[model samples]
Target chain A: MVEVATILLMGVFAALAIHSNVLRLAIIYLAVFSLLAAFLYLLYAAPELAIAEAVIGSGLVTLLYLAALKRNRVYTIGVVNEQQRDHLSDSYISHVERSKALREIRQFFLLREFEVQIVFVSSALDEALNDPAYDLIVAEDGEGFAAFTDDESYAMLELEMMVQMHGSGSAIRFVRHSEEGVV
Target chain B: MSDTNVGSESTILRLIVGLLYPFMLLFGFYVILNGHYTPGGGFQGGSVLASLFVARYVVYPVEDTDTEVLHAIQRVFLSLILIAPTVLLFTGLVARFPHYRGLYLTTMDVLIGVQVGFGLGVAVLRFAFFQGVGKTWRL
Candidate 1:
């Protein structure tokens, strides 16, 4: 009965791994599948194979898949404004959609062969900055605009230069989000 | 999905991995040493050892600069593994010291374990460094 349940769970995870749309979710499902496989190996009394599968399949393979997925084509940017603090206003959305700086930034990334996805995040700027999904975060405030990006980002210099050269009159400060204390 | 905090976010995870690190190393060596009497041998033990590197990488996403040294060490171990058996068997050393057969097997297991461990660790380190953290996407 235990073996049957393990097999069924393995099958489910395998199917889920294949069917999942998100790469990370698929990798996680695959890891879980491998873990089940390791359990099956243990049930079959193949401790060596179980150990190998548990370590390599679930651990090393998952890390490798995640590493490969890191080079994804999509470059996500979260756009936030003070108005989004309470709710996502339709006017704010339209305004962000029609922003020239956003268009320029999109075009910049598009020229570099990246699939630019501008997400109008309703979260606070600080919250959006904390989320690592956004490669870049553009926050609008009373002053002007603040773009937050990873300090270790290779494109930081280029991005800064581009922003400075092409930005309209308002004060746009590019903030490097250091990963020192966050870890 | 966000790649930054895959394994780094949870304090429990960090603490658990920290606690498991030494035990994992000890277990890998134990498996290798006891391969003659146990189910697990060099490859399994080596993989277990390699997972230590993976765990460290997951928690602290940093590019390992010591992979070249690991590569060199792996090559040396590989050569030793390939040469040791031939030298031992053809030179009639194994036949002469038949009582040392257990010692020989354990030594081979240790050599193979180290080789496999270094090889897989280097592979993981290279992958983790080269393709890590969306660093490849240099816009």
Candidate 2:
């Protein structure tokens, strides 16, 4: 009975929140929904996913959304296409906005067996985390994302991964962008 | 095209980047071809190719050549290159099945090639324009 009520309640809020432009309302809905998912994960004994979703989905992603809202006025979101497994083209996001959702792509990439190499050339920090193989990277930035960052640029992803292996607060060795080959 | 620091590159390193560039591009395509089985894919190879083009213009200036039409073509093709992959990816979602994902990725590789080629080609021309002075700067 409680499960049915949750399904109905969530389904209604989700459907109604589909096209609303109110930022507060959208954020609230996402928060509540993510919490609900955490509850389900706990019920199913999948604590890791529950925690990840709560921290990442409910916490970090929301922070990013807030940041984006601060940057831009409008927020546009797309729905998830459940059946999209083997399409040639990529752009089928629906559940959330693009960049925000893209931020979570690292999580999905982590769950997969294939390695991911993302290059972000901006003033911001490198955000790739949770993946396995990260190779031949170039970043002149400091520690901000991936929970850890190397101080230099142009090093194998292998080195960074090995360094980030200790914990979230670990720091990879720095390799200056202007400097010559391996030290 | 805007002023860049490409002028300072050592001729030898430039020579190596130039000599190895075409084969590197071809290798990108090779990665795309075997992407499903291998580690590389369309977007990776595409990005590498884009860098190659950027390097080419940094090495060679094409401002003296007719590049406006070529630049326009590059912009259109780059947008298209990004678009087509998305279409195919979504189509797979809608159909609830995997069709020709490999072929789709391959085609995406081709589009990226066109984009990287023309984008760098046009960028070189534009950057070269910055060097124009006196009579060369005539509108």
Each model's DockQ score: 0.35, 0.01
**B1-139: candidate 1 lDDT, tens digit per residue:** 2346555468887898899999999999999999999899999999989988988886777663589899999999999999999999779999999999999999999999999999999998887677434344456
Candidate lDDT scores, in order, read: 0.82, 0.49
Question: How far does residue A90 in candidate 2 sit from its true spot (Å)?
Answer: 55
The superposed Cα distance between candidate 1 and the true structure at residue A149, in angstroms, equals 23
In model 1, chain B matches the true chain B with a TM-score of: 0.86
Q: What is the per-residue lDDT of model 2 for residues A1-183, given as tens digits with 9 covering 90 to 100?
A: 666666677676676557555766787677677777766776667654654455445644454455344323421111222234234133432322234323443333333322343433222222222122333232222332122223442223443454456455443343433233332
How many clashes in each candidate? Answer: 0, 21
**Best candidate per DockQ, number?**
1
Q: Model 2 in CAPRI terms: which quality?
A: incorrect
Model 1, A1-183: lDDT tens digits are 999999999999999989875778999999999999999999999989999999999999999988777654668888888665677778878787777667767767865657787888877767777787887888887766677766677676777777778756524577666655222
